[model samples]
Target: MSVKKALISVSDKTGLIPFARRLVAAGVQIISTGGTASLLKAEGVPVIGISEVTGFPEILDGRVKTLHPNIHSGLLAVRDSEAHVQQLKDLGIETIDLVVVNLYPFKETIAKPDVTYEDAIENIDIGGPTMLRSAAKNHAFVSVVVDAADYEKVAEEIEANGDTTLETRRKLAAKVFRHTAAYDALISRYLSEQVGELLPESYTVTYEKAQDLRYGENPHQRAAFYREPLSDQLSIGNASQLQGKELSYNNINDADAALAIVREFAEPAVVAIKHSNPCGVGIGADIRSAYQKAYEADPVSIFGGIVAANRPIDRDTALAMKEIFLEIIIAPDFTEEALAVLAEKKNLRLLRISALNEPAKKVDNLFRVAPVAGGALIQDFDYKQLEENEIQVVTDRKPSEEEMAQLKFAWKVVKHVKSNAILLAKDNMTIGVGAGQMNRVGAAKIAIEQAGALASGAVMASDAFFPMGDTVEAAAKAGITAIIQPGGSIRDQESIDACNRAGIAMIFTGTRHFKH
Candidate 1:
């Protein structure tokens, strides 16, 4: 194959002039549209206008320029077939051996703070995608270029071998389809938001790779991080890594879990996470005491775990953290002494996320998406908080004021735990947590055992209703005085009867917080 004619149209003109110059020097005719043609001609590049090739003036505000049969047939026709070549000759259509195009800035335009719907709709590129798709579909003969980063390689290939190789064209075609798919997904997501459809008739999500991690959950697995550009919520993706080496996949996951649990409190709070489960949590008068209490709740589990705080880390907290080995520490800000002290630990991952102080909004519209074997599952975020009126006393005994406070705190912590999950709390701090167990009773037993003597007066919270009376029996044996759960299981009455017999106070939230 030999280079003959090329069509170039782009919104981003980086490296366009030099690329077009190289093509022109190699005896390839340059045909362009609007701004691209004007710029090339100004630079003495000898470009032919698109209207000259199609013999039709651009109409409808330049939206109807490149949709003619002359353009499509030139790009889509089979080059080696007798019928296709004859039809091209009979129709006086020239073959377009190359196409260089990029879509309009729809994502960038919609990302503005106050962009209107009309503004976004107008920026959607129709002719660009149409031409690129046609060229990509016929990539057996026509080479399609969508990214400026490929300019040097493409130009060198053409200059070296007169035309791009079949392998190169196939790769470019695949790239074109992926690019268009992501573009369409962005349009779909934005329109769905405008129409107030959290999940549309057809849902598609697109993400860009942020970085390649050292490994996934294990050292043998490969992994990378991807991020959604439209997400506004405070998340690990947006956190600023102030220090430390590249974070592993497990580190990112654990840090995210810690941040989510820490955000559940309005007052100064600290949460320690290990293996995507909260090992300890505390809310107190100051950040130092909160961290101290959280660490003391389960000092053995806090080793090498990620810690997140909902307040600025002061000098005292830093001093306490320096005494232990921690993988990561994230907070809204750090005092001068704290940062200096933390900086001493060269390998500790330190992240500063400003959104930690800002309250979460758009609860009703936010979604959490998880991928499965065949497809994905999409559901609304579990932002439900424990309201005073929503709590109902189901057992004969009512929780005391102090017990009620601990029950509410435990409920919030339980929401972030994996099912079957159990949490024990006293004085607004988590004493023990058991997560991701196969059975409810197993989770209860693990939590009770971890609490040890602390379980004597601590309140217990279950992420879901107890399926049997065994969990209630176990809690009662451990001297758990108060229990909080959704209370809608088929064996709910059995558990209630067991609690009453043990003289334990129990409350029903009527809302399950299953986090699996």
Candidate 2:
């Protein structure tokens, strides 16, 4: 078989030079456009400019570069069928066997706080996807590669089998479609947010595989990590494991819970999370004291729970943490000595993430995906956050100063617990949490039970609405003096009446914090 023709274009020049060199060694004729063409030429690769291939100069602000018939016909031509081959020959169009491309950096361009509209518009690519789709549409006879990581595999295949097989071409085409769809989603979401719309009718998103895990939620299932095409800010993708075994799915979830709960505290503190609920939490003079007190709050739960510190990890704090069997520890910074102390564990995941205590700000990437019966459900992640000042007194009796402190602590704890969440707190320590319950009353009872004697002076907080006063009656029975919740249930008045009659102080923030 003759050497195949390959089209190459990308905004990210990473790995392009070596990839193009290998392709050249395989005797593939490389064609590229714009900066990619110039870049390849500078690297001494035999690359033809798209304008030259099409016999048309790039026009319309470079928008009309690759939209011509020469490029599309070349990529879409069928190489196997005699009739299609003769038709392509009659049209004098070369059959393209491979296409490799990455889209324009639109999201990165607009991420700058002071990015101009002209800059954003200029960064948008017009012809890259057109060529990618054309190549993918003819996958039966053409291979489409969207990511540079696949370059090595493609090169190896051509070196061994003389060309990528039909199966490889089809798989590459699948990646092409996914790449284009994700690219479009990012563009749509950006434009919608720029115009202040909630959800658009159409969407596009782009993510590349980060790594393939040993297994998924279970050892038997398969799992892989994919991150957004853009930068990861405060996400699990960027977390650093200072020491630890390979993270299980449950470990990641619990670590996320630990981090999420600590985000609720404006003041520097330490929170220990186990099974997605705060088993221990405290405000302290410093992180070391806070962690110590939090550990003392529930030593049993501290055995393997994740710990999140709002302050930096110092030598003293790290040494203190070393005495525990924590799965993960997160803080803004870690001292050299602190990291050294942590390094001794050899299996503890240590993450240093800044900007953890920032006020709730809306994120553009909030689309959620969940599998349904026939398809999947996609919606924006709820951005509601309960500010300390926004809470309102609903009951006739107002909470005393002592009760207010515990109420605030419980409120913060409840936000991090899964729904139907019920958190009981005394001062800064979380005494009990009934998370993932079926009903509000049940949640209250579970938390009260966990609190035991500690429930006497503690305050209670709920993540969502209270259907009736049964929860209030339950709290009163458990000796809960103050309660804070999002009041939007069908029987809100009944709950309020029960709170008033039972002499239990209650307040509503009108904001629910349901993790599930």
- Each candidate's lDDT (Cα)? 0.91, 0.81
Worst window of 10 by summed lDDT in candidate 1: 357-366
Q: List the residue pairs that clash in candidate 1.
A: none
What is candidate 1's lDDT per residue for 251-324, written digit by digit as tens? 99999888878888888999999999999999999999899889988999999999999999988899999999
TM-score to true structure, per model: 0.95, 0.89
Best prediction by TM-score = 1
- In the order shown, what is each candidate's alpha-carbon RMSD? 2.0, 3.0
Tens-place lDDT per residue, model 2, 1-516, is 433788888888899999889888888899888899999888899998887789999988777888988888888867767887898789888877888889898877877889887788788777888888998998887788888889899888887776888788888999888877877777776778779775556544567777777787778888787776665466666676656677777777677777766776777789998887788888777788888878876888889888988888999999989997998888878889998889999888888777655534566656677668986777765555667688899889999988987887777677778888998888578788788988988988988998898898789999988988888898888888889998988899999998888888999998888777
Model 1, position 150, has a per-residue lDDT of: 84
Model 2 C-alpha lDDT versus the unseen true structure: 0.81
Q: State the displacement of the C-alpha of residue 401, model 1, in Å, after optimal TM-score superposition.
A: 2.1
Pairs that collide in candidate 2 are: 182-205, 184-204, 185-203, 185-204, 185-205, 186-204, 243-347, 243-348, 244-347, 244-348
